[model samples]
Target: MAIALNTKLAEGVQKAAAEAGLAVVNGQESAGFNGIPTEKYTLALVSAPEGHTFTLELSAGFDITAANIAPAVRAYLLESAKRLTNPRPDVFVTLGGLPVSFTNWQWPFHLSVSGADTYVVHGGATLEDGKTAADQYLKAKVSASMTVTFAEVVAAPEQPFAEGFIYNAVRKILDQGQMELTKSGGNRQVVPVTTRYYSAKQGKFIFNDTTAQQRADYLLSKIYWLSGVLGGGAPVWIADPRDAQYLNTTVEELKKTAESLAGEGILKLDPKFEYASSTEPLMAHHAEYEHHLQDALDFTRPTFNEEMRAGHTNM
Candidate 1:
């Protein structure tokens, strides 16, 4: 899989200097290509191959724009070029975002590619959160990359937090199902089952078959048709969204916490929903959870309890 690294990428030193209204010390641009130039005249008869080289060196107290940079870059080097491994700087990243500025907006990022001849790669980083600045860049690799090394600095993009695909899809199905049900329901056990088949020669044995699928289809055709498919699994809906993590992070201590938090006079509470299914959709069952939680908290609200003051927690 090719993850494009074209976006608002900047050197740690350059970023800090620019934020402080200070100019970059001396910005230079370069491109590295990987693979052989077989079509050259020297390789006409045989499959002899060669690659080219280019470099941009700047003087002190200078800044270079990303646009003026060359389209082709050197990714793999020949004997004439120098190769070195440098230090890894402390960096906060924000990847896969749109541009925010004209000057420091686009990055003069060095990139590598494979398969496709050339395509746009964009990226950036977050010093803090998704504010203040975004360093981005894009480049079409002169040749598809087998491996790459950024002589200067290569920016890592933002890692996804709430964008997990499988879990998100599961949650959507559950939430939509809850809307369809419109009624609060209790939790369902996620039973893992296997089929036992009769085998006279080998005795009865546990086996894998399409029985579960057939059952699911029967239910759908006789009762309700399935709206979608999540990978190979049948689409299912739930009435409780307090326990829905099919992706990202899931926990098993939610019920225990809910029971512990449930008290004498509270109705519904707003604790970190730490169920096994955070990716589950919001269900009508959760509406009652609110009431139960509020009652738990207000159980002693008339007397002003410290715990009822809404504690700050990061789960």
Candidate 2:
């Protein structure tokens, strides 16, 4: 029986050896053995003289010729035994996904107010004002419109606007009650006024138009901001649905390329092997794997008696 050279099996062995703090080189490559280019030892698969089974061969004198061979070989054999308990014929590989970037820009706004409020200024009598006292105070104390940027909002780890920062700012300015004037028992008294007299038509406000069309417009503008910023501040051309059409098309093209390569006899794909599609969001995949790192000590630490027994047996 001819033992096939399984790339995945080799990769798994390499992974296990690396986890055990072993330096490994795949295939019979150049450079050096035991940090010396003059000496070399390569690991390969070989068949027995009777051709009954296959065995792993670490080239001539490898047992004592190569440094760190004992621990590496032990790790490889232990992992190989574990893999034999449960075998998978197919391999899962990840193809590249679209990249995104972000930028910031200021947006414009305009607002006005009209209302009435009674107040006592310098011990004067009650006065009827056309605009609420709070509106006048804000107009004179704050800028006509503040600069609003979306960079941080988009990059926030939590869902955008979930912190209530923007909403709080708007509420503080337009909804928070102000101390105005009121007449009680023929005497001017300062009382809390919770009503907002300003009507913002084209600017940020605590309470603006809540129509369906207005809400849709607001959502679409935020979407536009995300797309523009992520596209490096340049206009992005994207489909309306923004589905994974590009990924699907790329996968189809890759299948075609693989078929072409197989026809040229450069590679082969088993008849049982089939292409798999991913429905997971591209961004979610990035977030999932961003912090996934392997540590050698994590694998080397003694955890279970069975695993320790296996390691000792392999050694």
Candidate number achieving the greatest TM-score relative to the actual structure: 2
Give each model a TM-score.
Answer: 0.14, 0.15
Residue 30 alpha-carbon offset, candidate 2, angstroms: 20
- Expressed as tens digits, the lDDT of each residue in 144-174 for candidate 2 is 2222232222222111111122222222332
Indicate which candidate wins on lDDT: 2
Scored by CA lDDT, what does every candidate get? 0.21, 0.25
Candidate 1 colliding pairs, count? 51
Candidate 2 residues lying further than 4 Å off, grouped into runs, are 1-55, 64-67, 89-92, 95-315
lDDT of 1 by residue, 1-315 (tens): 011222233233234323333332233332222221111000010111122211222212222233322111111111012111101111111111111110111222123343433221222111111122323222111111111221111112101111111122222222222211101211221111112122335432212122333322222221111111111122222112211122111123333333332231111223442211111222223344334323432331234334455664443
Model 2 residue 215 lDDT score: 29
